[model samples]
Target: MTGVRWILMPLLTSAACVAQAGWIDEAELELRFDDNLPRGQLKRDIKSDMAVAIAAEGGRGYQLTENGRLTLTMTLSATGYRQYSGLDHVDAGVGLAYRHKFGLGPLAPEARASVSATRLEYRDDGRDGWLYSAQLGIGKRITERLGLTATYEFERRKSDDVADRLLPTVAADVYDLTSRNFTLGGDYTLSSDYVLSAAYTLRDGDIVSTTLRNLPIFLASSAIAEDRVFGRNRYAYKMKATTRGASLGVSRVINDHSSLTLGYEYIDSRAEGGIDYQANIVRAIYLHQF
Candidate 1:
């Protein structure tokens, strides 16, 4: 966390060098509820939580000689989760983008890249880790009210405990892995005060399955002696999986600074060790932007 602070200070200081820098341009506060907090595949393993988050972002752009602008933005967010507080974290990100306008009104293409870091603190302290991600995306506006975007993302997460060492029969079950994701999204404004959004995502990566309710069969398959080493509820296996999901949301704008969104998401994941499962999530978000 200290290192991140040091990095952000210099970026904030450098904003003064740009003419169009809005040092503190926009801020947002959000409240959200998730029916499946850990993205659990099995219904029996699902847990629910509510989160409150606050974020602030600022940007600066330089006008190009042609019809484009180069921009840099910095964003910071802090969030707290309750019901199951172990998944609480803070995130910070910085992005750089280029936008080209075609002289035709309301038509623009943009390309962007960003890097972010997250630190998770858990009450149990077993699943805590630092997660880092990088993303690249491109978007184009087809009309004044509609836009489309495609993005590719990569992430790496490293946890503190070694699961293999804790359970000898498990095959290197450490909760550290790399993942890749590709997403296509679209948004349409139905009116000045309402917007509808949808997205589809495909992700391939490694995941840890912690809540195996059928402990005896799972243990026998892994060639491990039945011991209480994993306790009643703990992560037991690491496997490669592919997850595909989609989301739909409708947002109603209350004013310039406030809005409400209702969303639903569905995901199906297939894992290597017969841990395939599906999950559905419904959430509501209340956001205030300034």
Candidate 2:
């Protein structure tokens, strides 16, 4: 929080310099239930947890030209889990974005690009590092109450420990991976105060899975057990995987400054040389605009 505040102070101090400005300053509270919190593919020993998160962000946008604008934002968030202590984490990030509107057809088309950097701190005192992401998106407003968007994103995540390798096994690096995501989404206004949104995300990347040493693994000669597993570390092997996901959400506008949202998400992961699993999640969020 201190690091994020230092970055935010400069932006807040300079906010008065911009003219004809539009700004966003909001706080978000979310409650989520995860049937499978660990992203584990195996059916056995699956853990469930409840999580609560609080986040705040403030940003300002300045019109650069008739159709172009630049925006900058800083955000801080922390999440705590009821059962999974290892999943607790805090996040602080800054984002810079640019958008341009094209007045071509009846519906204006918009193009967007953004870059962000976030610091992640874990409660377990391991697997902590920064994540960097870049996104490019195109969107069109089809009607007064409907919009569609397609986006592509690239992200890189690093862990504090070394990555696991096949030979001369080192088990420290299970949290490190790079991912590319393609997403298509749409939002529609159902009424004066209600909205519906849905999206499908396809992610291809390297994933990690940790499981116990079993009989099938001994026959295949493919398993590598970590030294710390038998003693302290509960998870042993790190297996790579791919994931696909989808989400649906409905939001109710309580007022211009506040809203409530309910959402559902599904994820299917296929692990290489490991187990495969599916996950379902339900979440509720409240947003307050300042």
Task: Name the top lDDT candidate.
Answer: 2
Off by over 4 Å in 1: 1-23, 39-43, 62-70, 96-104, 121-124, 160-164, 169-173, 213-232
Q: Which residue pairs clash in candidate 2?
A: none
Which ten-residue region of model 1 has the weakest summed lDDT?
220-229
lDDT score of model 1?
0.66
Clash number for candidate 2:
0
Cα displacement (angstroms), candidate 2, residue 241, comes to: 3.1
Flag regions of model 2 displaced more than 4 Å: 1-24, 104-106, 163-167, 214-233, 236-239
**Residue-level lDDT for 96 in candidate 2:** 97
TM-score per prediction, in order, is 0.74, 0.82
lDDT of 1 by residue, 237-261 (tens): 5567899999999999999877888
Model 2 lDDT per residue over 165-273, tens place: 5456444455666889999999999999999999999888755444454443323333343423123444544445568899999999999899999999998877644
Model 2, global lDDT = 0.73
Model 1: how far is 260 from its true place, Å? 2.6
Candidate 2 Cα deviation (angstroms), residue 272: 3.0
